[model samples]
Target: MPSSSTQRNPWRYLRDADVLHAAVVTLLAVVLSAGIVWLGYVVHVWRIARRAPTTLRGRWVVLVFGRQLVADAPGADYRGRLARALALLREKTAGRVLLLGGRSGGARSEAEAGHAWLQGQGLPADAHVELEQESVDSLENLRHARGLLQGGDRAEVLPPVALLTSRYHLARCLLLARRLGFDGHAVAAEEGLPRTPRYLALLLMEATYLMWIDLGMRWARLIGHRRMAARIS
Candidate 1:
């Protein structure tokens, strides 16, 4: 027979084991969360690489927007890339090109520079290249351009508008285009572009904008239903 002193408390042993097991599980969960984030980022880049080019041809208008352009510029990478995108659009779609941006600090707005460069590349003067100089951001660019495409008629069906921008900017710009009721596709201009600090800036800005809008939109919807019920009551 076992002595009384030799008897063990099973509940205490179970509790101690549970605490240690919980700590180990928590550490593993943290590592798994980090791994999943990293894997998601990798997958996003891979998908972008696969779908960045526009394959459809003929008269599919391509719209490109970006920052100002400077002559004798050292790092005018965005504008340079914008120019390439414009040229590619001309070649691929054989459609009119509309560019939008603002002139800041004596540097030519991207719209102006793109028009000049496109014309210099032998694009037509009157209708082939149009410029919208008032927009400061991608959403504004698309909204104002969408108005032009619709030609002041709310009932007009939007054309297959295609957006051309840097690789990192395509996804967010596409979302903004859809939000503004643009029935269009987006393509990243992936040719002949240098490394861009603007890419990281755009990504951070987009993530912040999306996070705020998502939370705010959800709260608004919830409150909206409550207000509607109150009014009905």
Candidate 2:
């Protein structure tokens, strides 16, 4: 014999197979939808990595985003980026460089390490170069680099510049650069899109990071979290 209050609110009779099953179905739908959206972004990243480049004519500054150092030396990928930047310098097309990265799992900062490697390769002392040794991640890399470019005799607005990094990394770098108001194009460290298992793994990891960042930004903006949104803006 239940009280009238319980009987009137018939939802009190809800069982696991009743309301709970519907809840589970709804949850699955949401999860599936999110997965589809994430996969689409992954495809977009892949396309950016594989796109062929045309001749870059204008003189531009090249921003070599840093990778972590290994044994306090530039890793293979990091050296690739350095080599590409040096090629631009030798081609006499780009005249300036800003190496962006902080110390991570290494005694020396990535910028310092990369600069040392470039000098060892015989990069002249008189080349216009800048080191951004304080950024720890891609977003911060672009943000701090933005400040450096605009804070002095650099430029009121960015001049044409190249974002130099690994092909797998270039997608996220370009995304952050555009969000931070950079005027640039992607310059791959490697010449062709890699299909090796190792490179595929790199692509997957980069895609996940990109999806996380964009989804977080959208959610923050939706909730009117202006400060969170501005962190990436």
lDDT of 1 at 117: 64
Error of 2 at 40 (Å): 0.8
lDDT of 2 by residue, 1-233 (tens): 21223112225425524234334443454488977866777788899889835225677888999888899899999999998888787776668899998876567788899999999998966678799888777877888888888886444887667888898988898878887778779888888998999999899888876776666566666778676567676
Candidate 2 clashes between residue pairs 3 or more apart in a chain or in different chains: none
Q: Kindly provide the TM-score of model 1 when superposed on the true structure, using C-alpha atoms.
A: 0.64
lDDT of each: 0.57, 0.77
lDDT of 1 by residue, 1-233 (tens): 22233222324433554334433443454377865533444445435534677444666777776654456231354655555555665565637667766553334555666666656666634446677766666666887798788899878988887777766666666766776777767666665323558755655444444433333334445656454222111
Models 1 onward score TM values of: 0.64, 0.82
Superposed model 1: Cα runs more than 4 Å off: 1-46, 71-75, 89-92, 122-127, 192-205, 213-215, 225-233
**Residue pairs of candidate 1 with colliding backbone atoms:** none
After superposing candidate 2 on the true structure, give the runs of residues whose Cα lies further than 4 Å from its correct spot: 1-30, 52-55, 152-155
lDDT of 1 at 73: 30
